[model samples]
Target: MKFTIILSILFCTSIWIPQNPDLTLDTRKDPVSLKEAAKNHFKIGVALNERQLNGMDDKALEITKQHFNAIVAENCMKSGRIQPVEGEFVWEHADRFVAFGEENNMEINGHTLIWHSQAPRWFFVDDEGNDVSKEVLIERMRTHINTVVGRYKGRVHTWDVVNETILDDGSWRQSKFYEIIGEDFVKIAFTLAHEADPDARLFYNDYSMAKPGKREGVVKMVSNLQKQGVKIDGIGMQGHVGLDHPSLEEFEKSIQAFAALGLEVLITEMDVSVLPSPSNHQGAEITDTFEYQKEINPYTEGLTKEAEQEFHDRYMDFFRLFDKYSDHITRVTFWGVTDGHSWKNNFPVRGRTDYPLLFDRSYQAKPVVKSIADFLQNP
Candidate 1:
């Protein structure tokens, strides 16, 4: 009688449990199994977390295989530490990422040799609070650019040498880099990157450039560069997109505009946040509390069947666009590998749960994975 009851309980549990697709990445097999299918599709990649790779039971390379052709190191290669105190340069982390890429035959996208955020304090002010003169700023910029870029000349394939320089409202956000260096700082940053490695491709990457106002600003920036004969190779659209924001029409238009500039268009930092779908009205404010605020819960409500299908559909839409212009799109990097550790959870606004990535909690490719794989195979 006891055995019969135990068996009955097991049967009940099996019937109720939804079968999750075994999407958790299998370390035993090469992770790049999907890479072959992606070849005729687009360059599929993930922004790497070195710590995650180290913590894995097996090396990522063993499972990752030839799945990616490009990789962006998250925080290791940013401005502050690389150029911690003006002229002094550090290559410890930067070198590791670049070296790993070269060894693996992957293209290394230098994630922002320059940006308005995460900069060392010294870059902005002197010991006494006086800003560094324009000349000093320019000199510091030259030294950092030349040394960093020159050191990895051939190893680093492309660079977001300048990132997020403009605001969503179409104005330059004033950072110490901008104030001390003046307007020419933009020009100088690009110029120095070009000079450092004549063969390397240079880019000015930013978010919200799809908005009409900011798009106009980006158009002007590109036009000016062309007039000056700067070797700006590509425009990286940091595709940190939300469900309703930047409608498909807006996104497609942005792509067309950048390509029209005669530059390659790379969808860098690509992630579509699933939770917090914009309210009934566009741009409606939802209180960010986990509990329902009136009619919405900002964070995800777990992976329900409907939610899984939604993820696949959204990913398919973007993948189709990428396929439509594969020739122009050089790389499409998922900002991080898994949802648990992505920066999206606490960005733009604080204390918000954000799941804006391709892989889910178990490392298993969500329905989105199969969609991408199928697209690659069919394409």
Candidate 2:
């Protein structure tokens, strides 16, 4: 009787254990590419790094080819990376990146022509380390925009002409660009980009765009540019979000407001960070840094089942919102291709393992990929 009781107890324990369904794409009988799924709504894109473009990360390149229909260089096209010095231009990586997109027939986007961050030291300073004069700075801006945009004029379709210029409080960030050249810097940058490639679409890209103050600021700026005939094309809302901030209502408001100004709305640099933020931080300021804390980096082992579900649900909610505004939104681009490749791993607080993409570390598609594919395909 004791032996019988032991067997029954073991069986009951086994039955109570939960089973996780296989979420990888290989296991799925019907796998759909996100690009194909969202083709009718908006183009699906991903940021590509040098490794992926150079064939170093074969899995990432394969995933990029299979899933994304648009490509943007994550860092190579940035001002500092492309032109670290005054006159010298490094075109190897940027050239390779553009070629890869062209080979794939993907819509290529030049990340930025002018920005407060990642700009070369020489861009804003003189030989004696003082700020360059307004005329000198304007010339530098013109040369950089002309060279970069001119290289890929007809090949590249869109450019983030100016990035992160507006502050969250509806004021300007007062970067060296603004301080040296004043507010006309934005207009000049757009004008130079347009002159470089009249056929290419130009955009102003920024983060934390869901704030009412920021929304109003961008609308005013874009509206003013439109009125002045500055050749502006669209606004990129950098979707660097977390689990609980930038409520969908607020994000939708920005989308509506930007679209109301006759500008194409592109959801750019999107990543849903699953780790606990450092002090409720929502903006994607690359310079923002904080010391690493154990509590803030809670998911070092991996995301919990509950956390994974929450992550999945959060993405679905955002996608639903995007679908509703598909008429206004042109393209939706993820910041990175896989969780391991995500900047979230070392961002805000360095050395934290974070799962914040549709693909896991092994290049396997999470259930959310299939769910999104199914939802968009069927909807």
Candidate 3:
């Protein structure tokens, strides 16, 4: 009797100790990188500025390599920076950016082949400053797309073929591209991109994606494109959220709606701004500007514990949402790696310190990083 009792106790102990030894606690304490922790869910990515790619910021580079498995050029790959002169292309910074991604085995994303805001003045105008004919603009676009996309070809994994073409009210922005080439400019851009690199995935990226009108507009536009046999592979919903704005329900609805169209959905350019902004601020418009006020920039010294917790909670909620739809979200990319590198500081309201990234100014991962990893690992 005594021997049997001892044997039973030992068997129970061995089973518990060997098979399930405090998995939850162990995972929480484990220093798993974000990419590894979320590998099963979706790819983790970050935007890299020229400084990080040029070896000027070793600390940022190290953190990026450690935590991110995908990367996008913040500004270097944009139309203005890549080809400032019409025929003269700039390759130094862009080449370094692509090479860095390849050396690290990271999935590279080409930011934008065409955008109205950052496009060169000459692209839509003649020497007399008059808008070019539709044919002239189309040829210029073809040349630019062919030159840029053809050069990268197999290297870049995805391309944001057209950006910010639709407005918040579901109407097309009357930029030079639209005024001259009309809505077909979007079709032309996608076709040209496809011709440049058929293997590369193409995406239509935009902000204010959760708005009802914008969501419906994008759905209609993409549906029309599909009818015409456009090779669009995904829809990039720019995740530029605030602590309070962008209702989670609405965002999820947009995701489902986009996915219903049989296209992959990507949460791109994600960041949470903790600072107050003008009530009129609509979306991630780079040209929007406001005069600075001390009340708006309250956290110049540091975020108070309350504010920090709010920031943490905001991030946690978004990550939870992203995880819930992991099957539909192919990638979740932060706009910047560190709070110091984030454009939030100067966006809309200038010179306001904002803690809006997974890493702090000192290159240390915030508690939210581990919290996110823990949740994803355990959930």
lDDT of each: 0.69, 0.88, 0.87
Best by TM-score: 2
TM-score, cand. 2: 0.93
Q: Candidate 2: which pairs clash?
A: none
Q: Estimate each model's TM-score.
A: 0.83, 0.93, 0.92
lDDT of 3 by residue, 177-276 (tens): 9999999999999999999999999999999999999999999999999999999999999988888878888998999899999898999999998988
Which pairs of residues clash in candidate 1, taking residues 3 or more apart in a chain or in different chains? 23-364, 24-363, 24-364, 31-63, 31-64, 32-64
Q: Write the per-residue lDDT of candidate 2 for residues 1-379, one digit (tens) a residue.
A: 2234543454344332224333433633445899999988899999999888777998899889999999988999999999999899999999999999999999999998998899999999999999999999999999999999999989999999999999998898889999998899999999999999999999999999999999999898888888898998899999899999889999989998998888899999998999898988779898899999998988888888888877877887788778777778999999999999999999998999998888889888888888788767754
Runs in model 1 deviating more than 4 A are: 1-32, 53-66, 86-88, 277-301, 349-352
Q: How are the candidates ranked when ordered by TM-score, highest leading?
A: 2, 3, 1
The ten-residue window of minimal lDDT in model 3 covers 15-24
**Arranged by lDDT, best first:** 2, 3, 1
Deviation in angstroms for 125 in model 3?
0.7
lDDT of 1 at 270: 79
The per-prediction tally of clashing pairs is 6, 0, 0
Per-candidate RMSD, Å = 11.0, 10.1, 8.3
lDDT (10s digit) by residue, model 1, range 1-379: 2234543454445332224443333432223255667776567776776574344423344334445677887777777767776667777677777777777777788877888677787766667988878787777778778888888888788888888777666677687777777666788898899888988898888876578777777878788888888779989888777666677778788888888899988888878776664333222111332333423434455755556556656766677667666767877887877677676665534455666675566655555565467545654
